[model samples]
Target: MIRSEQKSPFRVYRGATIDRDEIEKLRAGTLVGSNAFFSSSFCEEVAEMFIGTDPLAAVSPCQSPVDRRQFVMFKIDVDLNQTADLIIADVSEQSNFPAEKEILFGLGTTFIIKEITYDIHRNLWYIEMVVSSEMFELKQEYTDFVHGCLKYTDADTLFGTFLSGRSSDYPAGISHLQRHLRKMKFNDPNRANVYFYLACAYRSMGKYEHAIEYFHRAKLLQKGLSSQSSYAYADTLSELAATYSLLNNTAKALSLLKQAVTLFRRILGANHIDMPLYYTRLAYVYWQEKQYEDAHSLLLTALSIFKEDMTSVFAGLSFTKHTMGLVKHALGQREEAISLLKETLEIRRQSYGDDHPDVAQVYYSLALIYADTDDKRIAFQYAQTALNIYQAKLPKHHPSLKRASELVERISSYQRESTLPQSEFHNVQE
Candidate 1:
């Protein structure tokens, strides 16, 4: 814990004595040995890979290591960031001495940043490692661990695929992730983070209930986990709330969101970058409940914060504008609503491209605006565009496609009726 704290402004310890052998073992690439003890939190990313009904087991235990008896040697990978100095320290503090006994044991290699360098031309980071011969006795498992780490590092690429609107590539990476997560022991604090990301990936794929399960596991794993960060707890709370919202349990979502909001306010005060997100979420829930006044008030506040920060996150911007448009349209402020919608569409198109789901959503919103305004011609065009985009890119029978098709058909019918001749209308009337 001291080592983890050493890297942060909130650190409570400095110049504390560390076990000499543990330090040497950590420096020597001999992590995951039998005697390790983690003072920091586990990696949630690893845990999220296995949150649903375990294909092999019946009841899932909240505070236990997963049962991986049926699988072959498992691989584990962790992405190392310089800011994760605390994670490195915690892993070192928990490791075993030459003859120590502990609940969690690791027998894997380590790669420090000094011996690794990124090759710009090759677009790869290379490392120089020397494994201890004594540790080589567990060579096969160690090799699997190295393989697991390599595979886990590809999460960034997988996340990129998701952002680029290629969510299908995510599940393909799941098998590797599942195998890696299963191999991890109960004491691996790093696994907590692994679970969190895995939950995010699940949520991205619209596996809401599945995501909620993993999110709970991540929260459980966070207990007694050490960190240099007070921000970690608040981040988890916010994530869980968002997941609950996705599950359509807005009451729980609101409760959790408020808790997270208070935590963030405590830690970062009222004007933090994350503060607006919480407000935005609260506004959305209000909007869902048809509390237009409350929703509008909160959205205006969130938008002001966002504007002042001037931070760039296209998805967030698009969502805020789209929601504001909805609230305005509901309030019968069509001109304001149309302006916001146009801005949202332009921003999303520039950032995500015309074919992106978010871009399609903007068009869908515009179609609704046009539909309500009795401009069936423009409404039908936008609806058709949205439907075509969804049908070509998304899976068959996707809800977005269905909704878009419905809108198109509604407008088409309206258009046909409006264009009928007066003589024909009179004859039908007679």
Candidate 2:
């Protein structure tokens, strides 16, 4: 924590780092935020990336020598015209190394990547960003929504919201929410909302059993809730259903999803913006149960609504397409399925960048589809890309990494035998 009186700003500090692939995930069009404090510096080495570009670099964490090409430089350009919510400090006069100008930014600031350019001559990559208030506003809006459902709008609420939503720190989010949960009285109106969010955070971290426990707890609190919103209850059911499906409890999953869809349709209307989500989820369950006809019909309904409002549902449309693609594959519409899945791939790359586990998931799905067809070469390519991403983004022992690696090797073995491989892979469940 710094002086509260000091104006708030953001700067990317040196020594703060991610791996090469993780670093590359901050593509030029991406919007990213730091959950920790960062500092920036201006030195001759940093400016050498591009002649016109000002130097920005960081010192080494240890006294060891640093590699030039692999080094990262951060520069923050805050636009005064956009909003006056942030401040920037040159801090050149106060620097320990007076020759190198330094800049400092506040903790938890967001930035929009402007450009990332590589200089061949100097063997360096230069990344420049502009400070943006949009992410902060979005996070705040979500926090406000959470507060409206409960009572507190204090520091813990803000921190927990940031961890749970924007930063995706599920463990920290779980800790904060759980601490908050202990403070709520048994019959408090806010208890249900806290339990609901806690369930979501646990689910995100793949603690399915823990998620189920919280969902059940939240369901019990529903009787005590004073809020008239059926939204939380419906969402809890829908999410719980998905988790159940992942756990292979298809019967329970189907029942819960049906109940969720009924309540969602009644409350938000069949054509509401969020209806497509419920429709698609239910369709996925049907597809998993091998009820292809039912799945197709639900997907078509969701697709029609998805077209009416594509703006707000940008990411949701991709999901609808992806689920339908799986259904189409099951229905033997391979051509259409591949096209739909490819669209999903592109949209996810734009939204989540190239290295996200979700993007790797799409790659794996496409590989499975191609593996079923005569196109073994295309299958190999997709499988290999998925393997590479999974290796980089997932833990060493993650099930996804194991599965992706196996898929790649299996495809290779099929090609080596010069025969059409039997399509024994499971259907796309995500």
Candidate 3:
């Protein structure tokens, strides 16, 4: 029996039901909590938070019922989508879990691991350990490790060095790419694409000035060049707009977004499939400007585009709807905001499954809405849900995690005060 000294980490797996094959896979890994498996609500929460850093962690084997004189610490590696593929080997000594484990990929879905293989000849592990979406929620040590890895691989890590390096040597890992880009010619349109990536990396690192510089460079490189693809111009303008927005220059952001919108409309047409992305950006800027009406109008347009376009872009469209919830709340459309947020939460859960960061976002937003409405009971539930996700998936010091913790504390106080027998203002219902 795997006896846990502490409460085990729990997850809620998504799907109609768990099958025997999946159960066997989970049992091999010493899965702790089955009751917390992902549900519709969990998926919604995960979808909401998918835009930012993944808030996910592994279920610790320490909570398993297996008793052992020697414990094995298996280090698992995950990719950009938060899917962990572990290569487990029996370690001679006990090792504390690494501080970082989750890897956030950028615009890619594959995890191609090379080298460091078992005997350097194994193709892959024979045993398939596919963790259900519901079981991916994590906290504490697991969260810290994942978040740390994310920070290490953040876009800025290389972008910063590239921009800072005046010499030809530049950064270590990306020098090959840089050399390849330079050899292809500086004026090549591909250079602009590289510049955009560099700009994004800078932006991720909060180097707004540098990001804006790279964005301008990308635009210049793209000048007098025409491509069959509209992504180049659209993405360049969007990056410029985002950089300005980050710098708190809302007017510039608005202008840049307008340019992007016009270009997208001209290239892809007004009702093109990608129109939703432009509209979403436009709405985001409007949101930053506190122009609720404009933002709402843009989001509605984007939503209409989504309804018309039946591509995979639907997932992105669903995300935009969730953003609209935040906008509505900002606009003081409390009822509408609450309703929209709830719907968005449901959609995320159904799509992504439970235990995804997007679902946690729903709980986070719901907690805020409930707190604003003074529904302490409901607020407490939402806050607890958010807190659980944050603790499991993000570092303890993360702003969102900290806020959730505070809300939990506040809710607990309220509960304790209201539950006091014969006390004045004891109105909290069990």
- For all candidates in order, the CA lDDT equals 0.56, 0.72, 0.54
Model 1 spans with C-alpha error above 4 angstroms: 1-186, 223-233, 417-430
Tens digit of lDDT per residue, candidate 3, span 158-205?
343344322212233244445555566554545665666666655544
lDDT of 1 by residue, 365-400 (tens): 778878876677887788788787777665555556
Clashes of each: 37, 3, 39
Best by lDDT: 2
Ranking by lDDT: 2, 1, 3
RMSD of each: 22.1, 8.0, 17.8
Q: Looking at candidate 1, what is the lDDT of residue 180? A: 55
Quality of model 1 by C-alpha lDDT: 0.56
TM-score of each: 0.55, 0.63, 0.49
lDDT digits (tens) for residues 1-430 of candidate 2 = 1224334443433423334666656789678887775566645443333233333433332222233225445666654546456555567687776655665666877788888865454344567888788876777776776766344334554567567654556668889988987886786666766777777777655577888998888777563343354676788788789889877788999999999999888878999988988898898888888998999999899989877877546568888899888888888898998999999999888766787667777899899999987888999999999999877755566566777888888889988887654765453444
Residue 326 accuracy (lDDT) in model 2: 87
Instruction: Give the TM-score comparing model 2 with the true structure, all chains together.
Output: 0.63
Q: Give the TM-score of candidate 3.
A: 0.49
